[model samples]
Target: MNNEVNLETYEEKKLRLIAILQQHSAPEIRLAKNTSNLFRDRKNISGPGLNVKSFNRVIRIVPEEGFAEVEGMTPYVDLVEECLKYNVMPPVVPQLKSITIGGAVTGIGIESSSFKYGLVHETLQEMDILLADGSSLTCSPHNEHKRLFFGFPNSYGTLGYALKLKIRVVPVKPFVHLTHIRHRDAISYFADLDNHCKQHIDFIDGTIFGPGEYYLTVGKFTESAPYTSDYTYKNIYYRSIRERESDYLHVGDYIWRWDTDWFWCSEYFLGQNPIVRRLLGPKRLNSVTYTKLMHLNRKYNLTHYFNTLLGYHSEAVIQDVEIPLKHCPEYLDFYFNTIKFTPVWVCPIRPLNKNARFPLYPLDPETLYVNFGFWNVIKSRKQTEPGYYNRMVEKKVRDLDGMKSLYSDAYYSAEQFWEIYNQEEYFKLKNRYDPRGRFKDLYAKCVQHG
Candidate 1:
């Protein structure tokens, strides 16, 4: 459970953060949090950070009401642990253990449950935001700050920093029953996926093995399981999907199944091998540890040097974009013929609140969208310009009328970026909430890397 928030201490910390921000008049404010799940590195953004690290705590969980009040910096792992004690969990828990609730809402968070409950921000009930002016205000759908409440999801801390958040939680059972349905054709596969979403399912996500192989995993909460398979170490979760028709996992383990392997990215560090797994143990075999090692590799340019020595032009293509469900097959076809990568993670998400439109990250309220996530380095014998592959992705997504999550590398021109992410509304919100421009605008922070 980590630590529970104290009533008085939360107030003290809020006042401290406000005073700190007031004392430091720098316009480029960022949170002084310890962990991050962001993929892209900031180039030169520098300013004194608000020390929000102490705000990581679960405030309270009301099981009967199916909601939990938590500090913005509380990680999903800690939030889940505390909620599970009451036999409930957040409606949509992001796969990563280190992602903070604030980070998830601001960036983007989606999991298997997203098909039913929508994305992480869509599940939020209320938020307490610390505006750039160092004033705190509570916002909800029916509150006076309703515009900020809806617009804050994709703001990435530009509008304000969420000091506390309340999210919807659902009851959980002892186990989860998973049924893996395999499909060979993309059209029929997506059709079946949309069909399954109509059912009263607890979780739905797909894994694309290749052009010829696809798997739709449907999970349901159950009271018991005959036996549960472990993928925390040694065994891998993705490989098991193709090898089995049905599987069982303890509820907690199922929520975190993809995290143990970082959705099959652990092989880069040899964490998948049995011997390596034994040496690293469970504690070290997580995204937090892997991210640290990745930083070291970046510091030393280990992968870069190796790729250069091999005479290959490399581009890191790590992105997540959601295309309309009807156009998913077309998206998949382009992906197979172009930025080819195997085992793409797909999760379906539609607005849980159809009447509520989040202008910053707009989606057709009636349309179902499937998020395609592929993270890997793309290399070729021939050389190309920077963002060569990512630009192709941005163009494709634009042509398809899809939305891209800005947590990773984005290669959009200012005009193109604004056109896709509602520039008019963003400026209006900025002028209203942060007229002084105390924080970087979405374009500078995301596209220009500040």
Candidate 2:
């Protein structure tokens, strides 16, 4: 509904998926333009490479009003640029610009600004979905398709495939104020977030940079000020090309700052092939060899530090488990002591009020969700290897009755997956809304498998 029907496949899998959908469903399905480009064959990389390639596409449908109806497949990077051209932006935007809107809605999505605006799904006005019967329906809070709208976020693809979405957008300035502050521990991070949320700051999040080095980055928009041609570089000390003469820059734009350059960088990152990196730049190589051995494609790079760090040796198996805000500390201890992996990325997400009504995880009223981005470094050794650390990591997660995130194929088994989210009520809703079971896909198979 946004502008085009965007869908695509990586390598033969994409074709396989498309074939599967065409075979299982009606042929009248329209393949919208602007499909995903990330579906390159996983096993066909020319040289040492990342193992996975993922993609999100944008399908658009112009409404009677000026608003654009978007598909879940819509990529976040493009959406920000498209919306900004019209002076509007989604309330919640992911830090990794390449994340798909659909990916965020179906999975437990988060971003730096979540403290104020919540996840991307919270900003939706309506969703155009393809039901199991191959029919299309628009779902929203005010309409009859309300049940689908409510359950669709964490349901993965079991409920339905999003055709288009009628979403709310907000106006944004052209610049950003990105300030990096050093913190001692998690205590300072939370306190700073609390203080920043009360102000006009647009976004905030921090990284636990090793033992004592913590970087808390915050962003906000301000009025245009006078420019200083000869600038002394301070916080952003990493890398940059020599500045050209007469170029004015906005602090707020950051990555969304340039669409084409961002896309090229994203494409290179996701390519994951060492040869590609060699072709692009040797600087892309990680100093850590194990991380270099990961063969992880660019899409997974968008994941948090904890997941990527361990993913070097182990395929990441994350479970977006929730504990009430009060219990977050307890859960953190349970998680940290239980796993051997160093540097776990814990995202403390604040879910919408309605999501709280379900009480899926053992949530408290002040329930701030602590998302477990559990990392498992893939090892070349067999499963029987005694020293293998991945097994230990998996065992710890299994011990905790955490809700497994239903995003990538690397997640747990179907039984294990559902046990995390308890899809029985969702099944009942499925029966009520789509008795024919037309929405069946790998996601449906996993969620509903006996």
lDDT of 2 at 383: 36
User: For this target, which candidate reaches the highest lDDT against the unseen true structure?
Assistant: 1
Worst 10 residues of 2 by lDDT: 230-239
For all candidates in order, the CA lDDT equals 0.90, 0.48
Error of 1 at 246 (Å): 0.8
Best by TM-score: 1
Q: Write the per-residue lDDT of candidate 1 for residues 1-450, one digit (tens) a residue.
A: 333445677788899988887878775788788788777777775765788899998988888878888999998999999988999999999998999999999998899998888889999999989998888999999988998888898889989999999899899998999999999999999999999999998999999989979899999999989999998877889889999999999999999999899999998899888999999998888888888887687668788789999998788888999999989999998999899988799999988888888999998989999999999898899999999989999999999999999998888989999998899989988999999998889999888886
**Candidate 1, overall lDDT?**
0.90
Question: Per-prediction TM-score, please?
Answer: 0.97, 0.64
Clashes of each: 0, 31
Residue 265 lDDT in candidate 1: 91
Error of 1 at 249 (Å): 0.4
- Give candidate 1's TM-score: 0.97
lDDT of 2 at 326: 43
lDDT value, candidate 2, whole model:
0.48
